[model samples]
Target: MEWSVTDLAERDLYKLLVNTVLPRPIALVTTVNAQGHANAAPFSFFNVFSHAPPLVVLGIEGRDLGDAPLKDTMRNIRATGSFVVNLVDRALVDAMQVCAIDFPGDVDEIAAAGLETAPGRKVAAPRLAASPVQLECRETVSLSLGTRHRNLVVGEIQYIHIRDGAVDERLHVDIDKLDLVGRLHGADWYVTMRDRFQAPRQTLDTWRAQQGALRAKPEGEAP
Candidate 1:
């Protein structure tokens, strides 16, 4: 059941990776072209990588047959040096899919999807008004890989917008209010945050106490 990555076909490798990597966060990224035209796209290959500098990464792939190799999102990010990462919630899922469609460069995906935007505080790109959380980012660096036109973009967050009532004065967030959705296996599959459980970390003292209690019990008795 094991196959070498070098031996596998490109499409097969992609299928294997995407199918096995359960529940990846979706980034409904918004960017503006040089002409100030807005563009929106959904990318599952996205995540918040660091907190010190507040960085996020996006994996953008180019079209196989097209006059322009790079996707509109990638091209816009390169031209503007900024973008917004809008975390998708249950209510925004339909709009997110609409943005995922391969529309012409001239077409405005945000408008087509019937989504409203707010002016970015630090970046040129606009943020989705309905998103639970919107992070305005400036491109830190981008790495081009191979002939496939794949790019790994690293962006530093400048400003963040959280929906009102989702956060408290002490910076505590209410997950139920946030209500974000994530990408699941397959092309059209998605998952909600309703089903989640937390397991707290164990300290050395707590671990030793548990071990002592186990030893104190009699081997033959149910003590």
Candidate 2:
């Protein structure tokens, strides 16, 4: 029931952490190399860290094959200083998985995955056409963590592209219409946002009013 991370293997710790996390958003990141080659990969260790300046963080790991020093996506970001974060939806799940493969550095993942790319307005990196949401970002900071295993990439949102009807002029996005998918534990596992319900947090006044109503009710009365 209890396991010490230091004692456990890295793979064991990774499995425990990922499974316990339940579900995480998938960032299908796209970046352009110095030679203009496009690279795409899906990262589950990603999330929005700030909103005022529109910032997001990506937790990237070293190459599993030990063949390279940096991940192609990370290398491209460092070379170009720009990247695109595309939301992985149910429609593009298969293609996204293909991009996750450990392909050669020169391989064009966008073409290899057979996914359509759209020219970004603000950034040089092309956005995934199938993705419902695409955020063009400029690298703000690339912090080296632990020397080897981890790298935290922080990016500032330059421009956002949402699918038609998904967002309004006020920038309010309709979640139901987006049908976004998230990464689950294990290989090829995914979760959908279609089955969703809202449970608003109760205020102090609202809680007091509910308590008062309960106290006023007869002992035998149903709530």
Candidate 3:
């Protein structure tokens, strides 16, 4: 049960980490190549890292074909310095999966996946028509992590597109209306955010009040 990470292969390590991470948000990223061809792909290793600058990161892997070069998503971002991060929802999970296929560079994954695209207001890449939320971003950094397999792409969000009912001008996103989908461990597994709860943060005064209430209880009584 106690396995050393150094002894494990890269693939095995990846499997272990991803499986244990639990319910990662799927980023259905869209980018356009220099020739104006669109590429769409789904990546589970993506998240919003900063709010002040509105930054997000996507972890992309290299291509399998010897001459295929970098992934279409990465190549397009590097070429245009812009991309779109579309949030996947339960309704569009199947289409999102189709977009994850390793299609040839010339092939338009969005068209192949039978998904519609709308032009982004602040970026050149098209946004998924079905996604509940879309973030138009400009690449701030693209750091190569390993020799051949991984690259960390950091982007600064320029514009965000949310469904009319999903978010408001106050930045409050309706969780139920958004109906966001998260990736599970196994292949093709996904979960919806229909069931949720809110746990408010406790301040110093609230903590002290709670302690006073507990202390006021009878000496032998259960808490």
Candidate 4:
């Protein structure tokens, strides 16, 4: 089946995009308004961007068909200039889903999810105690995308909290220990990090040597 980008409806394109993206990291973001009322919501359209300043991106969509109508997170982030990105692990998956409920802007989803919060050192937004990792970020910029105005919130990581056992002395995070979960297609679909494979990148010298051998092969052969 072929899909023409111009012909496909926005919803259709959105379905294709989310389904084909394989597995995307979930950002259980928390933000607080000036009044200190907290909001927690999940965004699968998120990922790390760079390390130099340590940046992450969250593609937060507005309340469309009333799947979480409260834009409290976005509003708080924009109002306060900071937010927290809490990483979701298998143990806290259900609690994380609880925060996704469409509560009122004044509702406190963190408490609704029955999770504890740790006050962020640098940001007004607090971090989730159940989260294995939390990033306290200050918003750098926000870019509007598409007709629906889905926003791309770019933030520089100001502080990071990693559970004691999740990282080693060498700063190598233990995947099994992290036990992270990723968002898959559909409402409740997800993938775990328990199954993994490693393929080391080859050195330039090794790559050049292999290329030389391939070039030296008889041209008429499989060229």
Give the Cα lDDT of each candidate: 0.93, 0.89, 0.89, 0.88
* Residues forming the 10-long window of minimal summed lDDT in candidate 1: 214-223
Clashing residue pairs in all predictions, respectively, total 0, 0, 0, 0
Candidates 2 and 4: which is better by TM-score? 2
Backbone clash pairs for candidate 1 read none
* Candidate order by decreasing TM-score: 1, 3, 2, 4
Residue 1 Cα positional deviation in candidate 4, in Å, after optimal superposition: 3.1
Q: Candidate 3: TM-score?
A: 0.92
Which stretch of 10 consecutive residues in model 2 shows the poorest summed lDDT?
62-71
lDDT score for residue 138 of model 3 = 95
lDDT tens digits, residue span 32-112, model 3: 888888889999899999999999999999977687658888888989999999998888888887898877556677988
Q: Relative to the unseen true structure, what is the C-alpha lDDT of residue 86 in candidate 4, on a scale of 0 to 100?
A: 95
Model 1 lDDT per residue over 137-167, tens place: 9999999987889999999999989999999
lDDT for position 92 in model 1: 95
- 217 Cα displacement, candidate 1 (Å): 4.2
Off by over 4 Å in 4: 65-70, 211-223
User: Where is model 3 poorest over a 10-residue stretch in terms of lDDT?
Assistant: 100-109
lDDT for residue 134 in candidate 1, whole number 0-100: 97
Q: Write the per-residue lDDT of candidate 4 for residues 41-121, one digit (tens) a residue.
A: 888889999999899999988767556443777878889999999999998899888898887666677888899999999
Candidate 4 or 2, higher lDDT: 2
